[model samples]
Target: MIVQLSDIELTARTLVMASQILVILLGFTIVYIAFQGYRRNRSRPMLFIAVGFTLIIGVQAISAGVYVVFDVSELAAGAVSQAAQLSGLICILYALRMEG
Candidate 1:
């Protein structure tokens, strides 16, 4: 048996790309909003949120690169992206716990 680029795979990949675009854009917007909040009243939690979003944006970019540039399997890309996402959240949690 042989396999070719079928319509289903193409459709799925297109959907993934579109979602990635939306995720990255939303992450950037979150970071921007957090930055503005931090700047307005100089809040520590807002700073942590901004930093978290920055890390999240980086992770999203790398995940998309793996999907589009490296052409990794979807499962592998999801695993890597999930790990990075968790790590980013952990950092933010630590930041929140620490004294500022």
Candidate 2:
């Protein structure tokens, strides 16, 4: 069966897709900047922070892909992304304590 979208619906979906791509790109940029700072400072805690940002990037990209492929609810997708982000941050905190 063929699916039909109104012009407004098509435009909205395109905009949502564009925003998701921008979010993914910006998240990776953050991770790259953090990694570069870690390299320059030789700081393990900064490395952990970079790792956390990497996880955030993964969440952004994977959650968007999941939403597109599986049509998950916004609440569910946000929950999944938040859980990943929290996990990464907790690990980073632990690494920071160890570095201290």
Candidate 3:
């Protein structure tokens, strides 16, 4: 069956996709800055922070791709993305607690 989206729906989806792309770009920029901080200070905490951000954003991006490419269910994709984000948050928390 072929379904067609209304103009508003199409525009909304387009805007959402554009926003997601922008978010990915911004997220990577943050990761780059954190990695640079790690390089400058040689801090394990900073390294972990960078990794955490990467995992969070990278999994989100990948999950979107997987959803589109594999035609996976939205619930499954969301679950995978949420799990990765949870892991990433744990990394960030551990970094915060780690002693310098």
What are the lDDT figures for the candidates, one per model?
A: 0.83, 0.82, 0.95
Worst window of 10 by summed lDDT in candidate 2: 91-100
At residue 27, candidate 3 shows an lDDT of: 88
lDDT of 2: 0.82
How do the residues 1-100 of candidate 2 rate in per-residue lDDT, one tens digit apiece? Answer: 9999999999998999799788888878878887898899887777887788778778768986898799799899989989988988886786678753
**Which residue runs does candidate 2 get wrong by more than 4 Å?**
66-82, 91-100
> Model 3, 1: alpha-carbon shift in Å?
4.4
- Return the clash pairs for model 2, or none: none
For 4-78, candidate 1 gives per-residue lDDT tens digits of: 989999999899979978988899998999889889988888888888878778776987687988859999988
The best candidate by lDDT is 3
TM for candidate 1 is 0.67
The best candidate in terms of TM-score: 3
TM-score of each candidate structure, all chains considered together: 0.67, 0.70, 0.89
Name the 10 consecutive residues with the lowest summed lDDT in model 3: 46-55
Q: Write the per-residue lDDT of candidate 3 for residues 1-100, one digit (tens) a residue.
A: 9999999999999999899999999989989999999999999999999999998999999999999999899999999999999998999999999997
